[model samples]
Target: MTPTIPTRQPCPPGACICERERLVEIQGADLRILYLTRQEEKRLLDRLESLSSLSDLEHMQRRMFEQLGLRVTIVPSLNEVRSMRGIGINIDELPGLCRKTRQAIPAAIRRGLEKRPEIAYELLNANDLLRDA
Candidate 1:
């Protein structure tokens, strides 16, 4: 008996090569990870810290999903106890999350998130966010 080696199908025409590469890299992995450069992370953190309303967070979430295929949701903790589907992190927990990962989530932003837990979104890492099923 002969064992078969798995093969990846070729990407279709006009498909995003970068995205294809990312998918290939994560094949059979337990987690889908997105990596960001330090500058990118800083910019994202700055934007997150500046979000003034739920609408802003919603817009950012939509853009992230569209551009990076990352599903993120931000809502008031008082109205929703937990996310039924995707990963959920409390707004007040961003600092601790960052600490566990040894990422640079500024103290000012942590303070802000603590003060306004409603504006919280999951903070994964300085350069990447991981999603594991």
Candidate 2:
């Protein structure tokens, strides 16, 4: 017998390639992976582990939003995320997580990047923010 797979609800109209506006964006001419929670981090990593190419990024994004079911959108830069309020990221714990994630992502991404280095170029920093408020 085959197990059934759950489908993610379609994103609301007007959001970009993502389910909402908080999934992807750009800042300072570079892409910033924003609004990541501890939850999203695990999902994203689970998806990443199954990928063999950079092209898989889109699927990673889609898979994540599908699991999350939020009003996500994928913009081009983090600057856009910076310009918004309640952008799905809870800034209250940002500074601390920024420090920890920066330090931890290197080791965490090392093995993954061994297969696909494009991710190295795409996000200089991927901060996993939580909105646990």
Best by lDDT: 1
Per-candidate TM equals 0.39, 0.28
Candidate 1 local lDDT, 19-77, one digit each (tens): 44445466574222233334455676677667675466568667755644445543333
Task: State the TM-score for model 2.
Answer: 0.28
Q: Backbone collision count in every prediction?
A: 1, 13
Q: How much lDDT does each candidate structure score?
A: 0.42, 0.39
What TM-score would candidate 1 get against the native? 0.39
Superposed on all Cα atoms, model 2 deviates from the true structure by an RMSD in Å of: 16.1
User: CA lDDT of 40 in candidate 1?
Assistant: 56
Per-residue lDDT of 53 in model 2? 53
lDDT of 1: 0.42
Instruction: Give lDDT tens digits, candidate 2, residues 1-133.
Output: 9975432333446532442233223234211234455555566555555556544644654654454332223222434333223122211222112333333333333455545655534432333332221
In candidate 1, which residue pairs get closer than 3 Å at backbone N, Cα or C atoms, i.e. clash? 36-127
Best by TM-score: 1
